[model samples]
Target: MRVAVTMSAEHEDARYPYDFLRHNYIVYLQNLGFVPVLVPNGIQNPEDYLTSLGVEGLVLTGGGDVDPARYGQENTASNEISPMRDETEFRLMQCAVDRHFPVLAICRGMQFMNVFFGGSLIQDIPTQVNAALDHRTGTHSIHVLDSRIEQALGIRVWDVNTYHHQGVHTTTVAPGLDIFATTEDNIVEGILHPAYPIIGVQWHPERPSPSPEIDLQLIRSFLDKAFWK
Candidate 1:
């Protein structure tokens, strides 16, 4: 199965050509048994190429911000913002949803999914949702919904890493989305489509020393849906 993982673009003046996620995500997908492809952050029309490759699955890798402009707000602070990446991944994800392909949106990927579904986000989480705990900590734990996320991960409950400032903070949900997990502070961390093999997590599961068991479980669960399809 071809799983296209989105890459992050760096400033022209920056030292590097690609962001940190380009390799990490590819390794994770390949380890999970899929042919990983890194789609550049900016593409004229990503869906066209992805469809041509017969990409069986899509994984919107982590990077940057969703540009508060997307969720109806002006930038009050400076943060990583990429329109091309956002648009490309959004289209890729929409196509995946339209065709019922297995998908996993991670970190910023999950934020875009929220905005794409007409949900708002907390621009600066420090002031928006304070909970004494660190949201950007590389090591953290979350509570997964027993009936949904547990079934998807094939595990009872497990810990995952975190790295993000903006997050979901509301009882309001996006259209046709099911809440799956949250942190101790009640910040929304996981979401699932009503009936597809689609899931999003606010935490990072493909970090340097990730839990291979949980990572494989998540991918296998999504792949299982493809097998039956």
Candidate 2:
């Protein structure tokens, strides 16, 4: 199975002079029987490119922050904005949503989906929501609601890693979307499109998981769904 994973453009530095994908995501997908194709940062037509390559699904990987303007907000934090990456992913997501392609969005990818569906996000979780959880650098527990994720994993609660400062606004979630999991402080963690085969998790699934079995199950479930079609 060929799955297109988004890539982050690293600015030229002393060591490396060109943009490239970190091996974490590529290795993650390979473990699940997927040929991971790292997509270019700025494509003129992402859908056309994917179609030509016969990409079966999209795995939106974790990376820099999404543009605040996407969610109708002004930038007030020190978040690194990647407009080109954001634009490319938005187009890729549009094609995925339109075609009902299986999707797994992680971290900033989740935020991108929320904005694409007319949902707002907390620009800075600590400063905006004042949560007890240290979302920026702490591992925390989240309760999984009765949704796709819970159904797939057959578990209710999970302790997942965290490394983002933004989270989905539950009340402002897009129509046909449901919050499947949330932190104790009520920060959105997992989002599912009930009408579409799409799932977005705020936690980084590409990272080393504390529960290997469950993490593998999550990846397998998505792959199974994609293959089912």
Candidate 3:
């Protein structure tokens, strides 16, 4: 299966710029026997082009902060913005929803998916929420909710790496979406559309880890969901 994976653009030089993806993403998908196609920054209607390329699913990879304005907020101690990439991803998600396309949104991709669906977010978790742990860089246990994801993985609790400054909570979630997993402090870690093949996680499954078997299983399950549903 061919999967469209989002990428981040690098400012290499003044004349020419380039878009690059993380190696782990390629390695993970290749190991699973899926072709990883890059959806670089600054593309209009990316889903249309991807569909033409026979892309079966999409992986919204992690990257810079999403513009708070996209979720009805002003500049609030966030990192740099990728307006073009945001637009491309938003459109791509819309197409995915329209076609019921399978999607795996990670980190910033998860946040963007929430905001795109009329949900709000905590711009900066450390500054905004009174949390004991540093979610920006650490590992934590997430309690899986009673949902399709839990049934697919058969895991009630799982430890995942964290590397984000923003997050969502249950009270701020969009209607009709299931909160799949949450940290001890109730910070949302994963979400899923109850009736669709779409899923999002606040961790990077492709990142190097001591044991990646479970992570690989998640990806495989997602692909199987896409293929069968």
Clashes of each: 0, 0, 0
- Candidate 1, residue 94: the lDDT equals 84
Weakest ten-residue segment in model 1 by summed lDDT:
220-229
For candidate 3, the TM-score is 0.90
For model 3, residues 60-165, the per-residue Cα lDDT tens digits are 8887778888988998776757777788888888888888788899998888888888888888887777764578886888888755666777778878888888
Candidate 2 segments exceeding 4 Å error = 11-18, 226-229
TM-score of 1: 0.86
Cα RMSD, model 3: 2.5
- Summarize candidate 2's per-residue lDDT along 190-228 as a digit string, tens digits: 887777778888887778766668767876886677322
- The lDDT of each candidate is 0.73, 0.78, 0.80
- What range of 10 consecutive residues in model 2 has the weakest lDDT sum? 10-19
For each of the candidates, the C-alpha root-mean-square deviation to the true structure, in angstroms, is 2.9, 2.8, 2.5
